[model samples]
Target: MHIEDHPVLGKQLQAPVKFYFNGQEYKAYKQQTVAAALIANGIKKFGLSRKLVQSRGLFCSRGRCCSCYMTVNGEDHVRTCMTRIDEGMIVSPNLEDPVIRSDRDGD
Candidate 1:
């Protein structure tokens, strides 16, 4: 859930923007970052660790940590905490494989 009324910022008044996460549609404020929107939507786990395969979530929230990495619009390894939300943007959990292979690779 978002902060409707911050002690200093007061009531947050922003336009709603629609985006997709894991094939599901979610709404977020225009000024909110992708990570903030996901948390507000009740999504805690952003992706899995490459080695341990453990769940990864928001940490640091300052774009300094890799814990909030997610795939955005076919781009992998995106820092959700630093990326601003955009309408129609597609976000998904990062895959274990850092390299994304396409059928064209013929692997």
Candidate 2:
């Protein structure tokens, strides 16, 4: 989660700003992710289990795991690990559609 002198993203990240999450406003930076920004601000509960609906959050900072899945800008089941946060972006928790997931399972 260290954005300073990043190998690819570089050091262009700037000061933080207020952004909307669901309905609440949160302060985030242009370099941080919706999950990373949220976690750094003392938020651990990002979403719930798909079947049991148990509270879950960022397990691994890397994108290998899907623990950080959430909705961004009205889309559903977006992996927060790979998605960058944008100003005024809306973040929320939602389930992935079983049928669509099944169809895209191997691809």
> What does the lDDT read for residue 59 in candidate 2?
80
Clashing pairs in 1: none
Candidate of highest lDDT: 1
How do the residues 12-33 of candidate 2 rate in per-residue lDDT, one tens digit apiece?
6577666676688887787677
lDDT of 2: 0.75
Q: Could you tell me how far off, in angstroms, the CA of residue 88 lies in candidate 2 after the best superposition?
A: 0.6
- TM-score, prediction 1: 0.87
Candidate 1 lDDT, tens digit per residue, 1-107? 87888999898846889999999999898889899999999999999888888999899989898789999998889999999999999999985776657775676
Structural RMSD, model 1: 2.6
**Backbone clashes per model, in order?**
0, 0
